[model samples]
Target: MPKAQETVLEIDLKALKHNFQYLKSKLQPSTKFLAVVKAFGYGSDACKIAKYLETLHVDYFAVAYINEGIALRKAGIKTPILVLHPQAVNFKALIENCLEPSLYNAKILKEFITATSIENQKNYPVHIKFNTGLNRLGFWHNDINFINKTLSLTKTITVKSIFSHLAASEDLNEKPFTTNQIKDFKTIAKNFEKTVGYKPMLHICNTSGILNYPEAHLDMVRSGIGLYGFGNSEIENKNLKPIASLKTIISQIHLIEKGESVGYNRAYKSDGLQKTATLPIGHADGIGRQYGNGKGYVIIKGQKAPIVGNVCMDMIMVNITDIDCKEGDEVILFDANTTAEDLAETANTISYEVITAVSQRIKRTFIE
Candidate 1:
């Protein structure tokens, strides 16, 4: 089906492929690669991105919740998918779909064991998340005995891998902390292997960790934002290609005289005769009010137009007085040249928040 000419997000699969290949080059032949497709592929359709990564031969795929894993499974994604934070309530659905859960704590571990036992399943694959200073979700580092006792009681499940989240692997200044986390993971992992009498796959490197700490890559490495063309550093970002381009068009052009207001609550008043271009995107579309009063802009006719007023729910007006533009003229919200990082910096946020906040109502166009 053809796309509407209004507002659209263009996803370049070629750029995605380039990023995957580039990140994969950083790994050893022995290390496995797991791609994250959670948050609907970081707000780009998960199923399509997973299908692409499958062809790239990514060994594993991870999602934050059970429903996301089920969605991918329903989409016919055959790769082994790990559900990062599966709730106990969704254990049945997860097992029914053959999705492996990352059992982080005692409650989840016990519940999953019981669930699998009820299903008459044996040696069902599961991942273990260790709390390596992220403190988000994971078994505590001191819980090795507890975990051993718990798993020994039930032969219904098996540990496929052990992993943790690196809180500051991207920050060069925090290398000391990152090093400690790796050391901690190694100590616990070594003991855990000894206790279990078998070695489970070990991983702790995130995208930043992947770029900075190759020694800690362990048996597998997970790439999330890097595969989406961000390396969390200026130097690393130079080597990656952005895959998503957000483009919109001017819905209307207003000629306002001096002292006239624009958008909601009279947030912006024209200082002189001005041309304002109203775009069909606003706070709801991920461009927030903090980007208002000239903090943010859009590229129109190869020129920058500053955002003028309070960003409305579905509209944002930009000053286009000096640039000749009209209704239906293409406006570049963000692209390779005008990057997500640039917009994120303008909003005092990060690229992940900006891209993920793009409402699902907007149509997405995937291109090679």
Candidate 2:
């Protein structure tokens, strides 16, 4: 590992494996597990994460875009890949790379059929997405006829799986809505299966869906945040190990008198004698300016140093008055103990944004 880099993301593969085992234990032996490795494996490394999951016998991999699947293929990933949001322009590349596209809309469904027919491919894998409740992607339950018509009209494409997304599986307050989504999905799956004359793999649960509604596991379960060591509830969080930790070094320190200001726009002014430390990380590295002022904090040698002043594009200032810290000391932006969830809560955001926001420029060191 290159310790020379000022800011680095440490990925513990062991912790990731532990999380995988814990999640797998929640599923039936027949149910498949698809690991979501989008956003550069949640800003760690897609190839590395996928490689690890492949060994654990993860049934499938889901990426947000086609390019991610292609990158994994180039890296020699043999497991089938599901592209959640596919575009017409990449339909050609999708087939050429053997990446399965999740056909949601009629246009994509028709276009993919045309593309595969031109290639004269038979039984090409494609996942049918149903819009259960998210209102984001997938076909409506009413569109089963359109889908059946399209499939019956051609042998160029095959139904690899039928899937849907749950919006509030983690929120108990929305259990009724979640239950309705499951009901709609099951009806759609059964209708589609009978209409198409083939039973495609069915899946609808995400991480929260896996934990909160296990019976709805269907044919498979997908996990993104959970695999990266985050749980929807406190009890689950304790059982999962955080896989990523953001660390940096205190580059410099300053001693200021009363009324002295620091950082751009004079966003912070010292009320009395104060000490501040600067770390080589900022909004550009995913630590946004909103986390500045007295909101976010960095752990320095077990002591909390609240951020002061505006977070710059490449640097941030933190008040370290009471801590016996110095230049070049180790600083933890967030770790297994303080987690991305805890840090994001302080900034009024979610863990997904916190980890994905970490700049790709930061070197990632994986612990085997």
Candidate 3:
């Protein structure tokens, strides 16, 4: 749309707003939304996304690291930010930028407590993460005593929120497992409240949880992929607008004779004479080699073209024998019609990997 310009990832801000409102509409007025904008907003640009969501009155913003929260604060984002996995080494920056850390373990908790005291931080808010099912991070249920002791030690600082990650809220068939997680979290919260005076702004649902388990939408929800579109497929709603579209152009075309080989290792040997189009995108540009040798495809003139041969680091060749596409024609890697999820299925991965793995070297064009 902006004329031929190398490979570009187009970001749609209006679609972002639509997705936010769409997800928010499912919640009650008392429920708050935490827009997870870490990893450059899932590789689409965090500062831009955060600024847009700020206008939409999002309750909070979340990042995986202290630097990301610091960047948002530097960009004039006043909304509360939760640093989900902040390290103790960066406690100074977190305090300086007013970024709340998710104290997942006792060691980090003590370090933060000491840092807060040294900074004379009175009532500085922080989040506590519990490992309900996602054992990758957060404190376990058995660690409740340790957490209680930490809180008692850090009376000067405030525990703003307590949260956990859901293992699978999208799978309706796994509803029993999800329910058990919810039940476990509820039990932990009750015990925590008994020790801490009140529940620390409990939250457990991610994007899918927010939609599928409204009963678990305690005080807040941290939505990542849903904000950028694509909910857990087990759910019914597919209304969220996709905020990003990856596009490229046919740089060259070739006519292959019968039995001719394309790309390295003769990976795509032609059955007969065929036409192929080369695109200026490859594994180096975030289109991994996993999509090579007819595994991946691109849409040219609305027709699907299967990628051929080993994908090069900077380019890929797609079969276009049956299509009438020409050199320089625009090609869509994935869009509203084709769907990134479909592409991910072909590549044996998820939409999250496809979107976030898009290399930073590729140019990005933002559209309002």
TM-score of predicted structure 2: 0.98
Residue 115, candidate 3: alpha-carbon lDDT = 94
CA lDDT of each prediction against the hidden true structure: 0.91, 0.93, 0.89
- Where does candidate 1 stray beyond 4 Å? 1-4
In candidate 3, where is summed lDDT lowest over 10 consecutive residues?
232-241
lDDT digits (tens) for residues 79-99 of candidate 1: 999999899998889989999
Q: For this target, which candidate reaches the highest lDDT against the unseen true structure? A: 2
Expressed as tens digits, the lDDT of each residue in 272-328 for candidate 3 is: 999999999998888888898878899988898999999999999999999997888
Residue runs of model 2 more than 4 Å from their true location after superposition: 1-5
Local error of candidate 2 at residue 349 (angstroms): 0.7
User: What is the Cα-based lDDT of residue 173 in candidate 2?
Assistant: 100
Candidate number with the higher lDDT (2 or 3)? 2
How do the predictions measure up, each by TM-score?
0.97, 0.98, 0.96
Estimate, for each residue in 1-368, the C-alpha lDDT of model 2 and write its tens digit. 44424788999999999999999999999999999999999988999999999999999999999999999999999999999999988988999999999999999999899899888899999999999889998898889888888888898989989999999998999999999999999999999988878899999999999999987999999999999999888999999998999999999999999999999999999999999999999999999999999899999989889999999999999999999978988889888998899899998898899998999989888899
